[model samples]
Target: MTGLRPAPARVVLRGRTVVPGVVTGEVLVSPETISGWGGIDPATGTITEARHPLAGVCFTGRILVFPGAKGSSGWSGFFQTTRLLGTAPIGMVFAVTTTKVALGAVVTRVPALADLDDDPVAVLRTGDRIRLDATAGVVELLARTEEEP
Candidate 1:
């Protein structure tokens, strides 16, 4: 069917460093504003935001791409819980890093990236293979094509 075509043949992104590390993994994208406080279940890594596009989605072991984190100073606490629960994202790519999200990234102890040459959140899609180099502030992405299953 015409609607089933794949996209993102191949692409690379650059961004500012947050946590400073390198990692490669599948990505989970959040098209809606994410709140670290009530948005995710730390133990399961599931997005709990009712109206969020990625609701009920688990980002564990993936590169999480989101515009930014919103609401409550408790953001970092929840993310830290993710780390302790072993359900944390391997890496994070944020469009804008606010204090709360920044702290979350730091406490989550995962490689984090932001302020890219182009917004990684928009350029990347869910299920894409990504290599996040937070130390070097770069992301190497392989966009999927319709040819691949």
Candidate 2:
């Protein structure tokens, strides 16, 4: 009922929603390798590590799709800062559930889907538009039809 269409590469992830909202945005997939401390910049919303492939990139207004949270427990605090900075992502999809990410999502108050059975990393690509229905616990993909002016 949420107008979700079968994506070209379909995958399903099921989890609890820590935050509540309807969100749709580009997918930024990171496998189970995102380090909490260096993966994101709370102040600027830019990924700041040179070693990371996604360095210097911004997650503002995007759907951050990741397998799980890794490294520091300080992860939640960063999201809190980003929220204060007003540069947080629209939503998040996690293949596995973690308390760290859960707390972050709760604090940030952003729509988050987790505990997915399928690997969103494998099926979802960066820049792919994602439609997340938090109310129904469903995620759908719609083709990115270029930037709208």
Candidate 3:
């Protein structure tokens, strides 16, 4: 048998930068909106809202891909706590840009991108390995999950 293996599928997406930085991590997608104020436990980095699709999921270190933030302006504060607690997302790619999310991304101090040429929430799936270059406004797909095929 041949020793060579096929290269992983790759895709590059362009978007507007929210918080400029670079990061590489696995994607954790939330198809629905996330409310940081009453929706997540910053200490654990887990979505605590019962009805949320990503509820009970811990986003620490993952690149959070979601529609956008919901609820009150306090959302940013809660997200900042995650960063302080050392459990913040390594990056963020969202379809929508709200004050809450924009502020949260800034305070979280992670690579963040928004208004992608493609719908990030639809194109990016959980377990996808990506290099988020927010400064360059690029999201490079590095690998896909084994379960995807």
Candidate 4:
């Protein structure tokens, strides 16, 4: 017997550009907001906030998908440290846009988009592959996470 593979699911989303760049990476969805000042460890690129869903999770290299930023104005500085430490996320997608997140995106110097047509936190799942084009304000879902049979 022969079997055929199904085509990969693809979804395109439009959003406001927060940064101008393009990058493709696995999605890391954080339903809640993230704190940059004391919520993350810049050196390790890991979330250090206790009780958070993604506590102890490292966002390095992945495309971080979340609502928005929280905590102090030092948010941008913490993310900047990640960039300096070479542990920053390859891309970022935000559901909400604020001055703090905008500044962080600018300093992180990564492809980032915000205010999408749909809530990315609801649409994207961890492990899904996506291509982010912040310059064009588009997010293309390249592939979905495979389900165990």
Candidate 5:
């Protein structure tokens, strides 16, 4: 799973879903370290003062793959505000689970897949196009080429 290969079949993972948007950009993978409050901007979907290495980057309509939630409980609210502001990820992929992220998922109602055995952050590149099926609990990687619109 580390090396490049043809697009694989949709992988399944059972977890909560968050946000409602179309995953149309390259996959941004982050394993284990994600701060809810600062990781994203509700008004812009851009990564705010999250302190993460990828801070200030935007995730609007992209598939945000991570291990789990981090930082304050206010994380959920941030995502809620982003949804209200029309700036939210199309879906989410988590390697682990947490109460805070779960609540956010329930509120956003976006496609989500969690508890993934394979590290999406490690396997998915920043520009890999992806499709998430929350209802079926599957994530399909399309080829990696140019950045998505």
Candidate 6:
């Protein structure tokens, strides 16, 4: 939906809305959990967790799909910084929700949904475009995409 790309076949997912909103963005899936305080660059939206699989990748403006949060309570703070820096994800789909993830989502003010019928990470692949209607608790995956290498 970003450009002239045609809408592809979609799979509608059901979940519980955390922060209600509608957003369409390229999906960025991560099996690895994020460490908050020292894991990310708020200014650039890049994953900086050392030795992590997604290190150096930028999740900016993407639909960040992951399991849940890790590390300390600093999780919310770092993500909040991302919002202040304008580098937060457009939306998030979590397989499971924690207080940390919920707080972070609200502070970042992004459309977020959790506790899905199926794990979003398993259903969503990186590079798949998703239109998330968090208010309605739906995730629409659009077509196969070139998986990031």
lDDT of 4 at 60: 97
Candidate 6 residue runs with Cα over 4 Å from true position:
1-9
Q: How does candidate 6 score on lDDT?
A: 0.87
Of the two candidates 3 and 4, the one with more favorable lDDT, higher being better, is: 4
lDDT of 3 at 65: 94
Model 4: residues with Cα > 4 Å off, grouped in runs: 1-8, 147-149
Cα lDDT tens digits, model 1, 6-114, are 3335577777899999997787778776898878899898999888888888988988988998988899999999999999999999998799989999999999998
For model 2 the TM-score comes to: 0.82
Candidate number that wins on TM-score, 2 or 6 = 6
Which portions of model 5 show Cα errors greater than 4 Å? 1-25, 145-149
Model 1 misplacement above 4 A:
1-10, 143-149
- TM-score for each prediction? 0.89, 0.82, 0.92, 0.92, 0.78, 0.91
Across 50-102, the per-residue lDDT of candidate 3 in tens digits comes to 99877899999899999999998899999999999999999999998989999
Report model 4's TM-score to 2 decimal places: 0.92
What is the number of backbone collisions in each predicted candidate, taken in the order shown? Answer: 1, 3, 0, 0, 4, 0
State the lDDT of candidate 6 residue by residue for 27-56, as single tens digits: 889988888888888999999988888999
Model 3 steric clash pairs = none
Model 1 score (lDDT):
0.83
Off by over 4 Å in 3: 1-9
State the C-alpha lDDT per candidate.
Answer: 0.83, 0.73, 0.88, 0.90, 0.68, 0.87
Deviation in Å, model 6, residue 52 alpha carbon: 1.0
Better of 3 and 6 by TM-score: 3
Displacement of residue 110 (Cα, Å) in model 3 is 0.4
Question: For residue 87, what is the lDDT in candidate 6?
Answer: 92
Specify the highest-lDDT model's number. 4
Worst 10 residues of 1 by lDDT: 1-10
